[model samples]
Target: MATKTSLSSDDWIKAAFRALSSGGVQAIRAEAIARDLKVSKGSFYWHFKDVPDLKAQMLAHWSSQATDAIIAAIEANDGSGREQLRLLVEAATDDRNLAYGGVRTEGAIREWARYDSAAAAALKAVDQRRLAYVAELFERCGFCTAFSRSGANILYGALIGLEALASGELADLRADMLALLAALLQGGDSSQA
Candidate 1:
């Protein structure tokens, strides 16, 4: 039996995030989340105007927690481009997940984006922001503009791929990322074993 408890908006969001993690967009129903949190249906209405409102807020929360916060933390390190790049790699390859939600949640959001224009737009913005920061870090390391963008794409693509595949070999990916970073910083466009 689930006990009824008062849930704040953040609590609802967290429950929603968990739901999103497990079942994609379809799983984010008010009834489902309320049941999961053992809260009343009224509790959800208290937090959000409606389902669309909740979804929009979810996207905003995801964007901030997943991309903005990571970049800010890395920048705050006051490290060189290469160092920041390394940290970024570390952040991506960490054992948890992308940043907020794990691979499944990311995949869920992406899946949702395909059918919803708003989700698509939100995802596009997140991608652009993430790509831009990676490019900036690469440029700070003295890479040419084209190469920086390319490197950002390559790295970002690799992370997305890993998440898509739900691969669990972080240790190997970390090694590969470091090797790739070394090659990249050394004026080589390709990575070697």
Candidate 2:
């Protein structure tokens, strides 16, 4: 175990996520994480003002690692928007590509959002950003604004729903997500659908 003085803010945040994945939002206590980290609560306080502050930082870290980083990576590759969208689908469903722990962490965060205003707000912001980015990709694929927005909503919604339903291996889920992406890409314009 690392010494208290050696623990960084990211270490605390990651331990908190592990706790969240195993338990729930209620389990993300500084003392509990400190215990798990084999550090003093003073280590947690050294990095955060309090538990709420840690929670806020956790949310920020999650948003950056999950959404922002994925988008940046996808954009870094040279591909048509259609190709990029396909990559996005793969990344979203691939358990190995998960930013934090995996589906459990996402599920826990969503569950926390149900009753926590800050969590809910963070979720809303992340959703909006994801939807907008997806919509932009759709537009680049020749879809009109309305169709792009609609497709984004459907695709993103399906991803979230799949995450909620996910357990153990995600082979079937990846296939299902790829099939959905193909269907969305092949579907006609908004006027026809």
Clashing residue pair totals per candidate (backbone < 3 A): 0, 0
* lDDT on C-alpha atoms for all candidate structures: 0.79, 0.85
Model 1 lDDT per residue over 1-193, tens place: 3333555676777778778878778888999999988767877888799989999998998898778888888989988998999999887667545333555677778889999999999999999999999999988887778888988998888777666555454436666777777767775334311
Candidate 2 accuracy as lDDT: 0.85
Candidate 1 lands at a TM-score of 0.84
Q: Which regions of candidate 1 deviate over 4 angstroms?
A: 1-6, 95-101, 167-179, 186-193
| Model 2 lDDT tens row, 71-156 | 99899989998999999998787765343567778788888999999999999999999999999999888888888899899999
Per-candidate TM-scores read: 0.84, 0.89
State how far residue 51 of model 1 sits from its true place (Å). Answer: 1.0
Candidate 2 regions off by >4 Å?
96-99, 168-171, 189-193
